[model samples]
Target: MEKNAPCTTVCPTKALKQDEVTRVVTHSTDLCIGCWACSMVCNYGVIGRQKEARVAVKCDLCPGREIPACVEACPTNALVFLEVKKLSGVKRTEAALKLARGMQGKAL
Candidate 1:
């Protein structure tokens, strides 16, 4: 969650916004015009077009909830919410762990 998100900065309708304190990016369908500007500018591809509604759609941080629905509802704990600054470290750690594990093959 960049302080100045590309999607929010590129949006003509100001539909996408980033919180200065939390650094959480939010998408507002009410203000969205379905212009696809956010979708195009978003590097993560989280923003998408809702063809039926003719508006952009993205996670709004679950509004009143502490955690997003997808993160909370994930049965396999696949999805996780993290601060932007910590994301790189997390990815690095995951890569290191995978590299260390490698291919075990058969244990004869």
Candidate 2:
């Protein structure tokens, strides 16, 4: 992230990572408060809070499901379930711009 990047994720240690270094995010389902921090904070928006799961879970992008949850739920057709390596240059630019804007008045 740039120096102006926003601290949108409000975790105790700001446990957000840049890319899917882990490919999948696994956490204790019982401990999640469904805060939607992963959804709000991630530039790629790989994670989201689901009422059905009662916790935040990141995308596995597994087959058999027609679309990922975010892509399916996006009303404006914003979210796309694209393979990370196949993501277009434009999408990456847009994500970076949005994250910079989110930084706004934050000091760090």
Candidate 3:
């Protein structure tokens, strides 16, 4: 079982639930009381309270979408969705290349 967040734990109506398969957190509008408990307890501050609906909202990882809208809209290729392991390898390679270039400049 996934760990319960403080936000989810405090939800009175059980409006928020995490999918076991995807680990995606979702809010059920029907069950929500608009109490803002989830929004108040979210550590990342990703939860948003909609003034119109008064219910908390958050990213559900863009379910059913091939690519996230933010990533797709980025023009500079600066934003990327990558696994942590791959990102770590890339960072390590970049650091090594930077160090090698500095050493080469000193040797010149």
Candidate 4:
């Protein structure tokens, strides 16, 4: 999750908080007052509204589940669940591979 997303910061009821261990942003529906403050400030547009309940909704990473249902149900594997450090390592490896390929047969 974003280190300091506006949605988390603007939540008046403190319903949204980031898990220090998982780094995942969690939402407490009980604490939510449907103020829409979090939704308004969400830059990623991930926050949604429950019209009937008047409560804001968002992916909470399926607490207590190994993988979120959304990620598991994705047909094309477009949605992936990875830890922050693992994702960073994957990106770094990709960059290194690309750089190595580009430097092939090209001397300093």
lDDT of 3 at 49: 86
Give a tens-digit lDDT track for model 4, residues 34-71.
99898888866778999889888989778889999999
Worst 10 residues of 1 by lDDT: 99-108
> Number of backbone collisions per candidate, in order?
0, 0, 0, 0
Q: What is the C-alpha lDDT of each candidate?
A: 0.84, 0.58, 0.78, 0.85
Taking the tens digit of each residue's C-alpha lDDT, what string does model 2 give over 3-28?
Answer: 32232335433444323442444344
Best by TM-score: 1
User: What's the TM-score of each model vs. the native?
Assistant: 0.80, 0.36, 0.63, 0.65
lDDT of 1 by residue, 1-108 (tens): 676789989888888888898778888788988889888888888887899999988877787888889999999999988875687799999999897677456454
Candidate 3, residues 20-61, lDDT tens digits: the string is 676567888888878998888886576888879878887766
Give stretches of model 3 more than 4 Å off.
76-108
Clashing pairs in 4: none
Model 1 regions lying over 4 Å from their true place: 103-108
Which candidate, 1 or 4, would have the higher lDDT against the true structure? 4
